[model samples]
Target chain A: MSQSDYDYLCDFLKERSGLALAPDKEYLVDNRLLPVARRHGRKTVAELIQMLKGPDSGHLKVEVTEAMMNNESYFFRDRVPFDRLGDTVLPDLLRTRALRKKIRIWCAAASTGQEPYSIAMQLDQRAELGGWRVEIAATDISGDAIERAKAGLYSQFEVQRGLPIQMLMQHFEEVAGQWRIVERLRNRVDFQTINLLTDFSRLGQFDVVFLRNVLIYFDRDTKLDVLARVRESLAPDGYLLLGAAETMVGLGDLFKMVPETRALYRPNVAPKKPELALVPGGARVA
Target chain B: MKRCLIIDDSSVIRKVARRIFEGFGFTISEAADGRQALDACVTEMPEAILLDWNMPVMDGYEFLRALRAMPGGDRPKVVFCTTENDLAHIARAMHAGADEYIMKPFDKEIVEAKLQEVGLI
Candidate 1:
């Protein structure tokens, strides 16, 4: 709660999660970390900060960071982006990847699993994707988030947010008064604990990347670094979708914003000449 | 193809919803309010009904109770669609023999997902 304590908390969060917390956000620190601090038997947040400064605060640090990191998610949180993903992005990717018969999607900061599962549900609906191999790699910085994402269970309140009742009935089963996503959907995504501040190239290339809504916490430089690293994993012809409020403009030049669209982007590569399609009569069509 | 009756006062919402269901190859019908929806149902019972909560002639709750009492009404799967998502309303709708529920401002995926949920598609 003191100036130095606030400084330590802010610096540590920025260092670990790239979240630039303002000095005046003591109330946020109090609200988020107080319960976490109490669990460690610390009398006050100051005591928790003191313990966090200790060399042997590995578990305590994980607890603190996980507590601070928001893990809110639901099936299809935002409708427009998913509609775009289903309507345009996947159709284009399916055509491009037809030769390979394989598609890889990475959902960065896949809190709890709804985003990735939402993607899986969309893919499942695509009759065009029959016999193709699809891999959705879902990752978050919090181990707790990854575990919960893996579990595929949601409370009534969690499912209430933007989740269709049909999805709840078809894809989920009531288990002990909570909804559990069916095994078929639960198996579609591979969950991992990934810290975006570090390298993520080892996760391999993705035909489509969803980094929605997680960028607001980062400072300008961190956003650039993160986008650059994300670019390393995105296929040259692949697409990246950001949150409605988040934009690639002035953040980095690894991508160019698509016009008249919400947040769809393609990699910033040299423009290729248009390939005309021939009509049945052999006339070239633009 | 299985038929689906979309009950909502808004023409735009009905059109938007019709496209989502028709994608699954279902025959689609629309009604402006609960009264017209009953008339549509009396002629031919649809395999599924996407009922909206608020309307001018009759609201969804009253229609649902009336429909369940009608001859052969229980055969069709009914999904209550509404913007009022409070737990009390949800409980009330479910209590009135509504099989499922979807919120307003839905698109293709949400519609298809609900249909799939009820095993209608």
Candidate 2:
């Protein structure tokens, strides 16, 4: 792939999803999208690009983007955030919301259902949450991944990664060698196909949000815009978790890292400033 | 030290598993087959046994059944670490008294997660 082609592809992805393809990602584009190109019957990547440019190629375009956007994730991808969630975050939220006995958790970029399902299992494990309603709302940029997330089925190897054996037995039932999350827990989450670049007010406010690992795909400006929109829907006292590798340190303090915690943040209350205004619903969907 | 038994035919697997289990604060023991594993159990029972499916003398299934039949055998957590993915095999293992299953080609995190599942760590 040429530099121009990579640039064009990056622009294309940015317009559809808020994903920014860095210039150094030509190798990644080659490795991840070559199979998509082959499936589309293109002899070479150049031909694939040309076909993507053809009239009424919207379907092909969506397929190609979805192919490239299938990021890798596992149940409780990192242990610390989840530990904090079960140990501190949820407990505090439960106490604060005890009057209403309601809590809403949003898992942005909930790939393959692992993250949201993991959240559900944790909430159910707490006997204190017996009568409380803890709603987990999960969304992904890809529709196919959202459907898979809704199904809550996982392969043997997939279940093995980061999933505790007892939790697997308690929350999932094995069917035809693959594990399926129990209906009781699987039904607790509401899955949606949402582009982070779009209006999320329709989803309403969240008491807790897990926006882990998805910010890296976007450029700096896009990250700021997404965080602003997240703030719109985030409760003032709500907690947010980013991936361990990710931070909001230089993002103008939209999220303030809580003391003695990694990736756990509280929304930094800032006066509405005109300079930070990012147009909500920035990109048009294909 | 938390005692753990690594029962497998492959020396490499045993060595690798020993390292992971040891890192989790376990004093490791190895057994070449189910027969040897049973003899080792008789000598000193471990808190957890990471058993592989296929072996020369006695396979994991037979060993699980025999182990379950032993006095106080059910006390230890038996986790099947194998490449097998068939439903029948899993059902057989569960019926034979296996506590959990972790697929092969795993690393330290996965091993630690499994031990955490069985409440060992």
Stretches of candidate 2 off by over 4 Å are: A271-286, B1-4, B9-29, B41-48, B53-78, B82-100, B103-112, B115-121
Cα error of candidate 1 at position A14, Å: 0.8
Candidate 1 local lDDT, A124-162, one digit each (tens): 878988999999999999999899999998876677566
Query: Which 10-residue window in model 1 chain B sums to the lowest lDDT?
Result: B103-112
lDDT of 2 at A52: 85
The candidates' DockQ values read 0.11, 0.44
Maximum-TM-score candidate: 2
Return the clash pairs for model 2, or none: none
Candidate 1, residue A149: Cα displacement in angstroms equals 0.8
